[model samples]
Target: MRSIVLLASACVVTTSSSVAAAQNPAAIEHHLRYAVRVDGQPDVAMDLLERMRSYHVPGVSIAVIDHDRVVFAKGYGVAAFGGSKSVDSTTLFLAGSISKPVFASGFLRLAEERKISLDADINTLLKSWHLPESKFTEREKVTPRRLLTHSAGLTVWGFPGYALDSAVPSVPQLLDGTPPANTAAVRNDTFPGARWLYSGGGITILQLATTDITGEDFPTLMRRLVLQPAGMMRSTYENPLPMSRRGEAASGHEQIDTPVPGGFHVYPEMAAAGLWTTPSDLARWAIALAHSYRGERGGVLSPAMARQMVSKQMHQQPPYGEGYWGLGVAVIGDGDSLSFSHGGRDEGFVADFFMRPASGRGLVIMMNGVAGGLMGEIERAFAEEYGFGAPPRMTRTIVAKSASELGAYVGRYVGAAGKDTVRFDVSVAPDSKTLQVYNSAGRR
Candidate 1:
């Protein structure tokens, strides 16, 4: 009986809402009604409701932009685990590192206003705190261009954020890795402009710089420069959203659909992971960027500056494709077919947005779960359903190899991960059928 109760409670009965899709009802209905993906040889369409349940995600909100407009923006499932509030188009979710692109846009807007220079040394604009000098900077200085491109050589890959009621640390404390802050010190890990290495820490520096230069708080500055202009009025860089706004926000959850005690975490690292927003709002921002990229009048950036923002700053290796990190967005594909995108992950929340700058077609998906595999599946479905070509189809040839050859690759190794050392053991099956890898704890 207990198992039955648990199973019943775990089941998801999601019904999507098209409150924001009224303007483009047909397009929205078509997208919500059908979810398609390739099943090896043929196309398979699954019910959106069932997919959410199968993935154990509490809720999801999506906004699809096409032909320079948001054709669909809707939400599915409950806002909280075992709760009644339904997620809708207006539901706010953490944008995570997606905050970077928005923040980068603000930076460019500030540049247009002549408040800061992208190529200038960032230390010149920051007054409250400055990057501590290191061997990496002796020959080269960190700039907004490098920082936004993840070539700043800074530390702290990303922030895990703080609990809702926990004491939040100041930006300086976070950068210095002091008390009340969880991550390590945000410092130089390599020479500046050396390569592409993601650093929420580097963005944090920009956050501070923006504040110091503008003489305004990060959120307020962003509103004046980027969000308001881009028509993302519902978005804010504020962390731990105001009490009044909580009701409109989706509560976060674990992969198992268990509610986080507090609806969401408080990300004081606003530039890196803090942004409470809706998919519809993000879609608007994407549309504005697309317009600006085509040398048209955009809300915040000039055409030339917008083009520069999406231009390749550095080359990124495979797994991300022959990708390139632009100012703050990932540029994929080439020439007229290029697209810009970014993914965000915070405790109990995950999100991503993709847009074709030239074509004005893209989608944004936000969910309140730690495990985000469902987002990718939904994206694949969107690609097929809406004809957004180039969903990553794996194409590899399997080859048979001798047992001796496989055995040679099997070995034990040790490596340092953060402050702890870990061991890994690689072994081939006795029957020579497969290989298994084990971590320090020995569980595969």
Candidate 2:
């Protein structure tokens, strides 16, 4: 069982802290800290190494963008735990769902060239396999626009990736859910263009359609259209990575000490989740996208297409929060506060990147472990250090309670709202003054 410390807040408040206007890259790296700090302990900040150890993350790579340029890129810890090989700016990690926005950028380039229409029925461009017709597609056919915006009502949220020793399925076979394919057949489960529901299955379909239209493989198409133009030389959509580049790849970790079998998994669903890249390369991609958005010439996309790529296409209300879904990224805030962001999670890797194109400021953090929460901590640190706005911190005061008082609040609790229901279990600690809470998922 897991235990979590419970804090009771007497009041809620939001306040911004002021930071130095200018800092060198080395100073910024030295201040790579945590969001939490004791009220009276200004010097008590958790450093990157301490947090990395606490989160069981062996390696972390970071890139910071300022004024539409990459200010600095750095890596910390070893590529694999218990190994001497240290992580550096060139170490590659799986970008996971981060591949979507990158792929979307290339797809938009094709649309700009008049090779494919965003509103056309995807099945029209699909030659090898077709999206099986259903009642959902009777009135509104699935289009590339809806797929990119995640309003196409497709099923299968993600891919699990195959072990290195296993046979990987072709994109078509994976879409058909045939032998060697571990996922279900891609299908429409709800009315088209109804609402936002993420579907990597839809992306796999686009991958096939893109190849069908261009007569070029997905990796080759992306290289020619996006990577080469954006200067992301260290990035690739090639699954299992190429043998010549394996030396630069970081191993995936299941935990602080546990490593994924055979070092890493192989993803044939390249468009959905297979992207091997460095944080520095990702930073360049973001910078290039921002340049195109500003009407800069010689970028991967035209200004008009880049603007559409970052515009809000639909509203997304997840259980945790609410946001707007752009073509391939999540749009946050509005006007001067507007930013586009995406997070990725593979079997043993987690990554995230956010950019405020208006201000030309952003940060990318990629980890070679399943420390998803740690990425948020690092983002908050960057915000505090670099003066970018971050999520509000909820500070609370600790209070001591009697054993009987704590016992009164211990038990199973249930709550319901509309069609949703939640369950939580609370118990008193051995000391009797503290309480531990567990959610329905058995996580604390």
What TM-score fits each model? Answer: 0.81, 0.88
The lDDT of model 2 is 0.80
Q: Write the per-residue lDDT of candidate 1 for residues 264-298, one digit (tens) a residue.
A: 88899998899999999998998898888887776
Model 2 Cα shift for residue 62 (angstroms): 0.3
Badly placed stretches (over 4 Å) of model 2 are 1-20, 23-25, 28-43, 402-444
- lDDT, candidate 1, at 10: 7
Error (Å) of candidate 2 at residue 436 is 6.4
In candidate 2 the C-alpha lDDT for residue 389 amounts to 39
lDDT of each: 0.77, 0.80
lDDT for 186 (candidate 1): 91
